[model samples]
Target: MKLTLRLGKRLNRSWQVDAMLMLLLGVFGAFMAIPLIYVINNAFKPLDELFIFPPKLFVRNPTFENFGDLLQVMKGSWVPFSRYIFNTFFITAAGTAGHILLASAAAYPLAKHKFRGHKVLFTIIVLSLMFSPHVTAIPNYMIMSSIGWIDSYKALIIPAFAFPLGLYLMKQFMEQIPDALLEAAKIDGASEYRIFWQIVMPLVKPAWLTLLILMMQMLWGADGGSFIYSEQLKTMHFAMGQIIQGGIARAGAGAAVAVVVMIVPIVTFLLSQSSVIQTMASSGMKD
Candidate 1:
């Protein structure tokens, strides 16, 4: 009877701790949401009301005039806003697809196959992730310029395809799959490509989704500001910059554009496999 009581007390304590942790996490999530709330709230307010002293959390005169103005600009641009959106979409899609395909292919060999200098190759790939893009920016730009890829989609998309982080994440996820499964496939006369596509790929779907979310976020916002600023081939962020420079009338319009721009990715992320994000978060805590 005493032992039973002790066990019950321990279980109750664990529940209490979990409840407290959840409450803390809820508070942190609200704090993180504040900035997004602020941007959205201000996006609907009139320009005159925007700079009001003490600031209004709720707009007394919410209007869609800003959105209207932005739409007009988008419709009338010599280099249409649609073009910028298209460029961003294509580059992001191509880069992400390439990353997933190449990373998965590269990781399979590194994770499952035996060959000469495989360890060296894997080590180099892992080490490459430590090297920041900023450190290589000048060299990369020079190479792009030399190859005549500046202000082109190739410059943006091709360089991004070599994603070390994606490769590393895939390798880690692939390791979690049992080797016996692959060997069994081999016994059944399955090719390596078939084994990878049919068997391994499905098991790592969570990791793939996580990488997709991450890559989409990065590529969708791929301004790099200094690199891709040419007028002929400006990205969405660069177009927003141009709108901002057009002065106060366009300020509200710019904010409205930004709000819309921000929503697309956020909604896409939330809608596409949010469960994977939760799984990844839980996994991180375990590690």
Candidate 2:
């Protein structure tokens, strides 16, 4: 009877610990959510309301005027916002697709095939990740200039395809696949290419989706504000900057643009990977 009582006490203590941890996590989550809520609320508020003393937290006259003003500015701007969107879309799509294809193909050989220098090559690739993009920016700029790719999509898209981090990630994910599966395919007269395309790609869907989400976030949030501004190309962020500098009358418009820009990537991310996020979280735990 004494031992049963002791076990019950220990179980109760464990439950109490779990409840306390959950409460702490809830509080942490609320803290992180505050900034996002503030931004969203301010986006809907008028300029005067934003600067009002004590700050308007829950009360504000929400209006679509900010959105209208932003659209008007976009229409009047010298830079073609539509064209900039197209340009960014092309660069992001080409870069992402290229990264996935090349990285996955390269990873397959490294992970599955036996070859001399494979480890050395992978080591070099991993080491390359340590090199900051800023360190090579000057050299890359010179090369791009020499190749006459300056102020062109090629300048952005081509270089992005060479992401060492993507390659390393694909390699690590592929390593989890069993070697016997490939061997069985080979015994059945399947070529290495067929095995990879038909068999391996499907199994690593979670990893691929995770990488896709990451790549999209990187490309979408790119510091193209400066590059586009300097080149006189009107990206959404550049357009927003122009609005911000216009005057207080345009503050609401700037906020509107900011809200739109922020929402697009976030919505795209959530919609595309809502299912995959759970898979990634669980898989990562196993690792």
RMSD of each: 3.6, 4.2
State TM-scores per candidate: 0.87, 0.85
List residue ranges in candidate 2 displaced over 4 A.
1-18, 53-59, 223-234, 272-287
Model 1 agreement with the true structure over 1-287: per-residue lDDT tens digits: 12234644653346667788899999999999888887887789899987789887777798998888888877877887877888778888999999899889888888787789988998998899899988989999999899988777888888877879999888877877788888999999999889999999997887888888888888887874656656657778777767768887787887787797787678867877765765476453311
Tell how far residue 265 is off in model 1, in angstroms. 1.6
- Stretch of 10 with least lDDT, candidate 1: 1-10
Error of 2 at 182 (Å): 1.3
Q: Count of backbone clashes for each model?
A: 0, 0
Displacement of the residue 1 alpha carbon in candidate 1, Å? 18
lDDT of all the models against the reference? 0.81, 0.76
TM-score attained by model 2 = 0.85
Per-residue lDDT tens digits of candidate 2, residues 12-36? 3466677888999999999998877
